[model samples]
Target: MAPLKTLLLVVVVLLPVANACQPPRTLHVPVFHRDALFPPPPSAKRGSLLRQRLAADAARYASLVDATGRLHSPVFSGIPFESGEYFALVGVGTPSTKAMLVIDTGSDLVWLQCSPCRHCYAQKGQVFDPRRSSTYRRVPCSSPQCRALRFPGCDSGGSGGGCRYMVAYGDGSSSTGDLATDKLAFANYTYINNVTLGCGRDNEGLFDSAAGLLGVGRGKISISTQVAPAYGNVFEYCLGDRTSRSTHSSYLVFGRTPELTSTAFTALLSNPRRPSLYYVDMAGFSVGGERVTGFSNASLALDPATGRGGVVVDSGTAISRFARDAYAALRDAFDARAHAAGMRKLAGEYSVFDACYDLRGRPAASAPPIVLHFAGGADMALPPENYFLPMDGGRRRASSYRCLGFEAADDGLSVIGNVQQQGFRVVFDVEKERIGFAPNGCTS
Candidate 1:
């Protein structure tokens, strides 16, 4: 009996030391495609889902390329939340209220619909009421978080002189409310205190039924930046196949992971004029072992002065887009190779894809492989499904048609959208200023 008592005392003392020596564990939040949130009715047509997604992708790309309508905030400008692709569930306030938020990498500012709304859009579940949370507090106008706003506002009531914010999106969606801090909790019970966010009183847009938007852009006010101190200045995401709907889920990871060790890294470029977007140096491209002609590295170079003529990696846009001339070259090369492989081309454009193939009788394996070459010899060899998106042929077969998943931009600014990034673990190490990619990372 005395020996057992001594052993118990030893364990009680050693447990604290063991826990103290343990390293920080990474937090993984499940991410779902927007389609998974509100699935189409059973009566919906076969090709309707793909068509709707393509249309939304076009709107998102247009918003990114427009670069107009810059708001008072450094984080605002052409952020079309209506066309956002993925979303995640988050908990707000002290009691932890669940809210579904769109996961966007194009803009900054984490905001959500709050109670006592003047004009709020329809959202699922209950709206976050700060009054119910003990930890909720409105930020003062003189606070550092308020001053961080590019253009801060003071309320008309001026009762307590609290800081206010107004953000406008390219698609006419706007959110106006008080800047406040509260406890933010994730699904794994990982919570952060004193996190600054917008409690939108008046909000409206094509947000579908989401509670709000979660921005992971490069701005200082971005969620990624706000949590950087505790989680490290690193974040990563692995987008699963959207067609699978809710059956499979990838993670939006915060902090370091074992997968980073094997990833191929490239220098993350930045444009001082437009600092919120992630830019990269693209060397060129290849189609079936043949180098594409016409466009050079100089063509894809970023003009720092104007913040134009560069490539951006975005998770909101569904399909990748290149400069008009560069895209023409890539399309022609891909078409030539596809034709040589005995694939028949369909006339006219299918949504945003121009080079579509009639895959009624053809196997998906026959499609040529496409590779994107970035700086530092980091090449992303895309699988057939990554570059070729299959569509439903209605009453016939779902895989009867497949289209090239790349598009041409009106301007020189090219975008690498989510379609090309599926199945790869894309790491944004902001502190190190480098982006890393590891193939087949979703399985982990």
Candidate 2:
């Protein structure tokens, strides 16, 4: 017979081994609206807020256009973006420096303003200081990690050579500094140690008070890639409806998700040049179940040699953008439908959106539902609210403006904007190279 003392010793010895082999806990970061930014902005009127966001969107898209170009040309090492609607709170470093950074699906590098900044932007929360972090380490140019970067140039060469990167956006914003490895912790307290990221020193941009950006793009150097093993290379976010006044809890969850029955899927196309962006084989689009012809060129094709066509799922940009011909066709169709339904067309262009309707005397512009028919039969249907913005934002005529939330791209590219992504759970399955769309996807 085994004694009680012998049993206790065996159990104690096995416990440590079991814990070591166990996977880290799943990270759940609550993604809230940018309006909750710390230090806050000067309270502006609703109209002013809308205009500000629109202007920021233009700047961000311009940067994205330039980023894709830079990727093919190999002229730049880093790209910086200015604005985003959702910001995630992540704790980085050994002691942990909580940073409020914009969540961007377009760019690949997770960067933040660091200390000893010769130049810096006005950031709200505490600026992350690498020196304060016990686990901080810089990736040298000669190392494999440094070589993996899109733009890797070593200011200090060797095994310990510091990998320095310089990224300039099309909008005149830039971030330049060292590529480093640090402990990246999420709100869950669990963390991935020695995660690679950009520690920005000299930087200039219109980023309002937020520390930096959290890059969740499709690239080897992206934050998502670095943390892949911990979560099986998967991440999904459920964006709340921005039109709602009462803020509900929305979130970004790491690791695998249950196969949602209502979810639709489309394969992610291959793009060697600008692989960071999520490219889907978008077959066509339809308004009121009627397909608009002659705008086929507007749908960007997934071709490596061309590097021109194809669309990306961008969470950074607010409105959707399609190639010129496609945008024109879409606008014409929407306007025709709205006019037929008794929506008074406003004169001239309202910002970047062309289909501005006077919803003063009319009920909310109930344009027919638009559906995005992706490759492999995944149809993503968007309500009228996804493509149109109510100036007043309520039934009781609060403001006299309503504009289409879609835009025309300078290049023949298409972007599924956040507005169109509202009230749905958009899943980026990087491992399988496919995207999933579930109706009314929400996360806490």
Candidate 2 collision pairs = 78-167, 124-209, 140-161, 300-309, 300-310, 301-310
lDDT of 2 by residue, 72-156 (tens): 1011112122233677788888799999877778777778899989898877678999999998888777765566666776874
Worst 10 residues of 2 by lDDT: 1-10
Which 10 consecutive positions of candidate 1 have the poorest summed lDDT? 1-10
lDDT values for all models: 0.72, 0.68
Candidate 2 residue spans exceeding 4 A from truth:
1-25, 38-43, 71-84, 156-160, 243-248, 392-400
lDDT of model 2 at position 361: 64
Relative to the true structure, candidate 2 reaches a TM of 0.86
lDDT of 1 by residue, 1-444 (tens): 000000001111211010111224665667877556666578765566566656656656656656652421211112222233667778888798988877777776778999989998777678999999998888887666676665688776563589998877555667899998777777556776666788999987656577887778777677777666556767999888766765365778878777545688888998876677788888889999988998666678899878778988888776788887788889999999989988888888876678988765888877888889899998888888888888664634546678888888776778887778888889988879988888887886
